[model samples]
Target: MLNMQLANKYAKAIFEVAQDDGKIDEYGTDLKTVASEIDAHKELASFLVNPQIQPNAKKDLCAKLFKEELSVSVYNFLMLLIDKRREVLLQEIVREYQTLSNAAQNIIHAEVTVASALNEKQQAKLIEKLEESTGKKVVVRTKIDQSIIGGVVVKIGDRLIDGSIVRQMQSLQKQLMAN
Candidate 1:
């Protein structure tokens, strides 16, 4: 919980900077790139988060790796995290920043689970339906869950719309038992 709070705090600070510069999406993309690199290279991630490693060394390495890739503000933000010994929260901070960015852009992410993969047309239709229902732009991430048996389950934030065969069967069973 404390870590999340810290991440949110850091994310909000950088988000505001991005907002002021009118580069919210660009900053988000830069953060994502840095985070993705760290996540993809486990050894590099360990080096950055290792308390035994000196902050100067981490900052130098990061500068060499990202100085050309990231904007000045974002590169400085990375250095700030190293100075504060909060580099460990890089991923969480990036996630929180993305959440803020998405909300600001009036976009919502949805997780759609189905018994099998939806083809292009089916996926588009589902996205259209979700957008129509929510009145917000929808970004869909699809997952295949065989246990669903059939049908779809859509999750958006706190809400879950379960139209899966398993759920329907369970509902029918409950009704029959109540009779």
Candidate 2:
């Protein structure tokens, strides 16, 4: 809980800075890159969070690795995390920043699970329908789940619309059992 709060604070600060500089998108990309790199390399991630490593060395390593791709402010932010021993929260911070960015841009991300992959026309139609319903710029990410049997399930934030054949069958079975 404390970690999430701290991550939100740091993410908000950097997000504001990026917004002011008209570089929010760039910073988002950079933060994602850093998070992805750390996530992809277990040794580097372990090193960042390891209490055995000295703070200065960790900061130095971060600077050396990210200097080329990250902006100065972001680089300094990473160093600050090292100094504060919050380097382990980098991924959370990046996720928070993305949330902030999306809100600022009035963008909504929806995950659509379908029994089969949608073609270009179907994907576009789904996105358009979602946008019309939500009144926001909707970004649809799709996944194929054969277990759904047919139809689609859409999840946005805390709300879920389940139109899958499996779910329908289960609902019908429950009603018949209750009867």
Candidate 3:
């Protein structure tokens, strides 16, 4: 809870800074990329969040490793976190920043999973329909789920639309049992 509170605070501050600098989109992508790298690489991540390691050493190493790769602003921003001993908040801060950016832009991310890949026509139709329904920009991410057997599942925020064949079969089985 403390981490979330701190992360939200940092995220809001960063969001404002990035927006003012016209780098909100860039910062958003960089934050997510760095967070994913930390998540995917276990040993490095462990070293980063380990309280046993001295903060000075962590700052030095992060600077050496990321100085050339990251934007000057991003590198400086990270150094500030290190100085504050809040490096562990990076992932949460990134997630919160994404939420803020999306909200500010009136954009919503929607995930659609189906038994097969969507063709161009289907993808276009889905995007058009979602745009019409939401009155906001809907970014659709598609994934294949063979286990669904058929039909599709659309997830937009907390709302889920499951029209999959496997779910239908399960519902029918449950009805038969109840009868």
Which portions of model 3 miss their true places by more than 4 Å? Answer: 146-149, 163-179
Task: Tell me the TM-score of each prediction against the true structure.
Answer: 0.91, 0.90, 0.84
List per-prediction Cα lDDT, in the order shown.
0.97, 0.94, 0.89
Q: Report the error of model 1 at residue 113, Å.
A: 1.3
Model 2 Cα lDDT, one tens digit per residue, 1-179: 99999999999999999999999999999899999999999999999999999998887888889988898988888888899898999999999999999999999999999999899999999999999999999998899999999989999999999999999999999999999
Model 3 lDDT tens row, 138-178: 99999999999999899999999899999999999999999
Q: Assess the local accuracy of residue 178 in candidate 3 as a C-alpha lDDT between 0 and 100.
A: 100
Query: Can you list the residue pairs that collide in candidate 2?
Result: none
**Any idea how many clashes model 2 has?**
0
By TM-score, how accurate is candidate 1?
A: 0.91
Ranking by lDDT: 1, 2, 3
* Least accurate 10 contiguous residues by lDDT in model 3: 63-72
